[model samples]
Target: MSATHALRSRLRALALTAGLIAAGAAAAQTGSGYFRYGDARLSLAHAIAVIEEPSDQADERRTLVFLSAQPLDAAAVAAAFDAMDAVREQAPAGGYVRLCIAADGSECGLFYSPEGFNSGGYGDLALQRNEAARIAGRWQLAEGDFLGTPYDFDLRFDTPIAPAPGSALPAGGGAPGAAYNAWLEALAKGDVAALRRMGGEDARGRFPEDDAGTVKESLKSLRDGEPLQARIARGRQHGDQAVLWVEGVDRDDIRRRGRVLMRRTAAGWQHAESDLSSVDE
Candidate 1:
């Protein structure tokens, strides 16, 4: 073949390869990737935006690709996140938020970053991701080590998270919210009776066994192990229900956050489980 003809053939091949690459890039931006699970039709990118925006300040840094089982229900999931966000903003303080929605439309994995980390701290990226996944209802996934230290986690969810039906509790200095703050203070002082009295009956409904033994044990672990140092990021209220963010430290001493759902009963506001409800401290 003539030299000129050979050069032309090579140019054509290069063009074809470039086009293939561009197509792949576009697919990735649309949430195509390995380990994609959940609602097959949901737009992972959109859901990710809903969870990551407040924390990242609206600039999306990466893509989330999940093979979904539900149709692209980005609208509903995003709405849920928005409702939750509105309630969180009502809190006395604010913090960073991250979330992930499953494709089936029944679950979401999430977490928050509390105040104080902006100054300086270790970047516990793996724990942050794992915790968020667990919060979003990915309990079935096996626990395994993340980063170097021993750990266990999975982001696979087959069930739905409790609806984050926006806050419904009364604002400051009322029964439950104020009472909850008192519980925190009392807990710090190891005043178990004060904690019990402050906790409402309905609060027991959602908590494990709704008894002092369970809660006291959990609180004790926090007091001794991680030493909960959290900023009251925010609180939300809607009717008798509420949510709280106690931005605490992660395993690596980084400022990660946890949340609790408040359930109000006849006596006063009670505490329930939230994504961060399982946190040790």
Candidate 2:
């Protein structure tokens, strides 16, 4: 062969080899699963894992989410957990499967959609391969009827774990203890005015002007039949944002723990998000 022709043939071979390598790399990063709820069927195309830190109320957990329509990057996965409502509202025509795994490798939660299937009667979940960077598993649930609808689920995934998001900002600044304490006190006293003042925009919106009495009753019922005596145990703050971990016991002898996300404003720290759950001894 001529030197020029030989060179051209070599270049074509190299290009084909490069394309095959790229396709293989893409395949390695992807995973597959599917489920059917009632008559709706969906296929999952991507898998990602997110690590959740231990809260004052709950243990550390890892969540594996399978996406149906679109692939997600690490930041997008983090954002999905942070703002799930927004993600759901903007989600495309496909559904998702979420599996929460505890630190000890047990399945803690399973959820899927197309109407929801949160009722947990999981039959089998086998994690044949579990590693730091990769997980392969199969999940199965027998056919059953729920709330008048018939459904069944089965899923399998084999994918690399997307890198965990960076650690949270270091705990600093004065814990927003005062605001949290005041909010709790107001809740106990049924003081609508104080509660409104300490609540952030999202929290304040929950209190409707036309339903003051209902709001008071709702707040009163939040404490159950006993009063809560919670206090902030620790906190982390960065700029205008902060999170406080609270620990305490109720009058009924049940331990209550929670975490509150706070945002600073002209009126001092206000509650933006709060989650409190009881832990039984």
Candidate 3:
């Protein structure tokens, strides 16, 4: 071959070798990541990050579901658990899982981290067919990639509310029920007078009439790609004070959302600041 032709061929060969080396590195990065629970490995497909978040209380904040590059299968799920186990064998943290199956567990779910299960979740995400509460599992991880695992290994959820559309009131929420009703009426009819009456006793009162009316009008139009369709989920009483949670239902994900706090007042329940936060593990 001529010198020019030989030089071109050598350059092409060099480029090919470089491309192969790059491809190998990409593959290593793809499979290099994994979190372990005991001996179980959890491949880092995607994660539901909730580092310092309280597991209870459903809200409308979107739960971030980490999507695996590949569709999650039973085998991949098992691999992911293996990764989780690898981490757990260390720091020796405590974690739990909630699995559901048919009448017979012919089909069963791989044990999932509570963070994974509850991340970005509003209300309860029922994993059991009978709507059973959580089933605790134990695993320990070192300085691995996980948030604080539960300690007691106790299932704190009594009725474990899922993020579907329904009114799952807690044992005692009547204290705030009146206030919630007032809100419903005010919103339904765009009643600014009721808003003024229920406003907080501060300089700004609670919600101004104009603001309330504007809010109602906006909510009436919330169906167009709205993140939350506010609804009363449940509440608890603290003597004269009570806290009612309004679920911000995610119309898109169909599985994630956050919570907003509504506290009982002399007139009724007054809207309060939202506790919106998240984590990673």
The top-ranked prediction according to TM-score is 2
Give the alpha carbon lDDT tens digit for every residue of 1-281 in model 2. 99999999999999999999997775465557567777887777766665544454345546564555566554455433253443356564676767766666778777775566675546587886677676778777778677777767677777666653333543332547666667777777777777788878855655666887768666756556322555665676656777666776765677766666778899898867666677667
Q: How would you encode candidate 3's per-residue C-alpha lDDT over 127-199 as one tens digit per residue?
A: 2222222121211223322354422111111121122222444643454655644554554454556655654
Arrange candidates by TM-score, descending. 2, 1, 3
Error of 1 at 111 (Å): 16
**Candidate 2, superposed: residue stretches over 4 Å from native:** 1-29, 57-62, 72-87, 119-123, 128-134, 141-154, 158-173, 189-191, 202-215, 222-241, 251-253
Q: Worst lDDT window (10 residues) for model 1?
A: 115-124
TM-score for candidate 3, please give it.
Answer: 0.29
Q: What C-alpha lDDT do the candidate models reach, one value each?
A: 0.40, 0.65, 0.37
TM-score of 2: 0.69
lDDT of 1: 0.40
Provide TM-scores for the models. Answer: 0.36, 0.69, 0.29
The alpha-carbon RMSD values of the candidates against the true structure, listed in the order shown, are 16.8, 5.5, 20.1
Report the Cα lDDT for residue 43, model 3. 43
Error of 1 at 219 (Å): 4.4
